[model samples]
Target: MPRVVVDVMPKPEILDPQGKAVLGALPRLGFSGVADVRQGKRFELEIEGELTEQVLGEVRQMAETLLSNPVIEDFTVSVETPVAPVPGAGA
Candidate 1:
């Protein structure tokens, strides 16, 4: 199996109130030295069996259409292969 990792972040031009709030609260939360913070989303998807170019295309489309907002955010995708199951482990 293969896994796809999606990382989405709001564009720099957009207003990130959530990130700003977190940054402001970090010092009070004992997280000093943190100069800045940006909010983002990470999604892990387990893709069964082999992954074809078509699947990659679909993944990109899905990311653009549903996973991310094209107006205010940008997203990147990474693919990782899952370790094979041990023989007879679940038997």
Candidate 2:
């Protein structure tokens, strides 16, 4: 099976309150050296068969229409490579 990933983020000019809240909490949580934080969304979609240009195009359309708000958010689509399990790592 093939997989696709979509990443959505607020436009740079837009204010992200959630991101600000996280940034404010980081220092109190004993984490330092982080100057900023921008919250976003990631979606993984599993394909039923071999990945093709049509499927990729459909995924892009999906991202644009349902996954993100084009007015204030930007989204990127990409193919995800599966990570093979390491030999004996679970042992």
Candidate 3:
């Protein structure tokens, strides 16, 4: 199966309170070297069978209509190639 990945994030001009809060906590948690953070969302859709261009177009429409808000956010869609299962390691 091919999977579709949708990533949605706040527009750069928007204020991200959650990201700010996380950024503020990182230093207190002894984590350093991080200047900023922007919160985002990722959605994985497991689609049956091979992925077609029409399916990709539909996914883009889904993202534009439901997954993200165009006014304050932007989104990207990608198709993930199916990963074959490795030979059994468990007895």
Candidate 4:
């Protein structure tokens, strides 16, 4: 199985209201010395079957189209697969 990790975040130029709200609260809660705060979303998916080149292409397109907005937000994708253990004679 292949694991897909998607991290979506707002563009740097764009102002994040939610993050600002959280930051304001942090200072009031006796947590000082906080400079900046940025929030993002993470998604983990397990993809079964053969992860062919075509499938990877499709996944990229899907993430661009539906998973994240290209205007105000940017996203990154990471693909991971399990590695088989090395065969060896144990003493």
Q: TM-score of each candidate?
A: 0.84, 0.89, 0.91, 0.78
lDDT of 3 at 5: 99
TM-score of 2: 0.89
Q: What C-alpha lDDT, on a 0 to 100 scale, does residue 66 get in candidate 4? A: 88
Candidate ordering by TM-score (highest first): 3, 2, 1, 4
**What does candidate 4 score in Cα RMSD to the true structure?**
5.4
The models' CA-based lDDT, in order, is 0.88, 0.92, 0.92, 0.83
Question: Of the candidates numbered 2 and 3, which has the greater TM-score value?
Answer: 3
Deviating ranges (above 4 Å) for candidate 2: 82-91
- Which stretches in model 1 have alpha-carbon errors above 4 Å? 84-91
lDDT for each residue of candidate 2 in 1-91, tens digit (9 for 90 to 100): 7789999999999999999999999999999999889999999999988889999999999999999999999999989865676987872
10 residues in a row with least lDDT, candidate 2: 82-91
Pairs of colliding residues, candidate 2: none
Candidate 3 global TM-score: 0.91
Report the lDDT tens digits of candidate 3 across residue range 1-91: 7899999999999999999999999999999999999999999998876799998999999999999999999999987777786798552
TM-score of 4: 0.78
Query: Relative to the unseen true structure, what is the Cα RMSD of model 2?
Result: 2.3
Q: Per-residue lDDT of 1-91 in model 1, one digit per residue for the tens?
A: 7989888999989988989999999888888888778898998888876788888888889899999999999999888766687987873
